[model samples]
Target: MTDDTPAGRSPSRRTLLKAGLGAAALPFASPAVHAAARDVKISMQRSSVLFTVLKVKGTLAERLAPLGFTPTWHLFTSVIEPMNAGAVDIHADVADAVPIFTQSARAPLTFFARERGSPAAEAIIVPADSPIRTVGDLKGRTVGVSRGSGSHYVLAAALKRAGLSFDDIRPAYLQAPEGAAAFEQGSLDAWSIWDPFLAFAEAKRPVRAIANGTGLTSYHRYYLVNDSFVAAHPKVVATVYQALVEAGQWVKANPEAAVALLTPVWGDLPPAVVAAANARRTYQVEPVERAQLGEQQAIADTFLEAKLIPRRIDATDVRIWTPPAVKG
Candidate 1:
């Protein structure tokens, strides 16, 4: 699983062009012969604001068109299932902990890009009026969280920091909406989740954060591509990576504009809530480096100790694709 090439070194642009232009110069082909556009299926989730912006703006499709590729977008509640099923070519973004489970399942995915850690982005929150005022108070209380999510790791780390274990709390495995409903009904002691769900809940309800990933986890989100797709379409991968980089930059540079663009598609969440959620995120996309896998390894170990994932895995032992060098 180790790469012979130096870390951060990927196939060159020239090499990608050569690979993508296969049979274009066939001697027997007519002068008008052209390659049919291949479809690149991309998975999108509501929480991934950059991908949402790209989809709304048609940025990815426009970028891929010149490469003779057509972009096909698919929405998913959770992308890991489809990704493991090999149903998509690219996954827009997913929590840091997600890839670990995928890796344990031996999914053929390659990390291409990642947003920098935004520690405050995910948290464990309890009702503001609840007697549970701290992470330690949840020793025997019911906590809600999405299984195998970044917030799940946040809950685990927060519990461990408070000298508790996953067994200390009764976990209610639920999606964001379901967890929100349970929390509202006073059925759960605390709800562990990420923004804009976190932001939406805070704005809509009276909940106080007991602990976010601040001192525990980095909360880095990643972009991945199918390994088979990476091999057959290196140039397409590069294009998608660059587009994400640009999209990240755009989101950071124009916060108000970005929120305006995302409001409609984000389940019509309030602008203030969206902005608050975005403020907690760095939105700075960078190439995935092996050195950054330290937190990933920690996440894997945490999940393993909790018996969440199936088996142990070397988090760093995975494929990483570097984006092509930026042109002046």
Candidate 2:
């Protein structure tokens, strides 16, 4: 199962937009192609601070224009679905735990870049006035979380640390927006969520962090491309990666500009909330380091133990995008 996609000349936009092949997903490992290109199909969740910056800056489009890569972005709350469906070529700002599930399913995904892990950015929150104070108190309570999300892993790990399991707690699976609403309406005892949402909840209501990713999960947001997509147009990955790095730097150095541009797009995410989300994340994007994949493996093993994924996964075994220069 190797993608022996030839690497000679750069592909045009027509070559890049061809989506990944589906169906073998995660039961076995195979080589993913990331060489040819037409237009780059990308997906970004709303809370992906760095990608949101990219969307706002339009830098990827500008950089890719000369290469004949038309950038198409879709908003999908979850990370793996679009890639799994072959509807997107690239998905950025995903969590460490997500690709593990995809790899478990043997899907065609390549983690091209990684951000420095920052553990405190995501947390399980309860109303500040609520009686539940710690992870132990969550037993038998209805908690909201997005299935297969970083927050989901955090919540599970937090429960295990407190001597509880998923069965001990009533888990309500909801996307980010719905979870926030459910939490606000007092429908959930606790909400496990990540930054932007975590920051939004904190700013909109009085909430207390019951547990964060610290000592539990690395919470490293990732940039992934469809296995075939990367094999088809590896340079597209490189170009986008470079743009993300610059945008991340610009975001940190100019908070006001970042917030002002994103506030409206983020459904009126307050300047403070947007700022907090950015502050918690490291925007420095670089090629994925093989040694650093242990955090992902931990998440996969945890999911396997909990049966969230059908089987075990060696997360480090999947495709990783190294820049062409590195490859040469």
Best of the candidates, TM-score: 1
Per-model TM-score versus the true fold: 0.87, 0.86
The lDDT of model 1 is: 0.78
Report the poorest 10 consecutive residues by lDDT, candidate 2: 1-10
lDDT of 1 by residue, 1-328 (tens): 0001111113453442332211111111111213587777877665767876776787877888778887766656666787788888988588898998899999999999999999898889998999999999999999999887888899998888899998888999987667777777788999898887788778877889999999888889999999999989989988887888899889889999998987655544579987998899998889998987998999999989889887889999999988768432
lDDT of each: 0.78, 0.74
Q: Residues 126-233, candidate 2: write the lDDT tens digits.
A: 999999989999989999998888888999899888999999999999877678778888999999988777887888778999999999987787888887877877
Question: Which portions of model 2 miss their true places by more than 4 Å?
Answer: 1-37, 325-328
Point to the candidate with the largest lDDT: 1
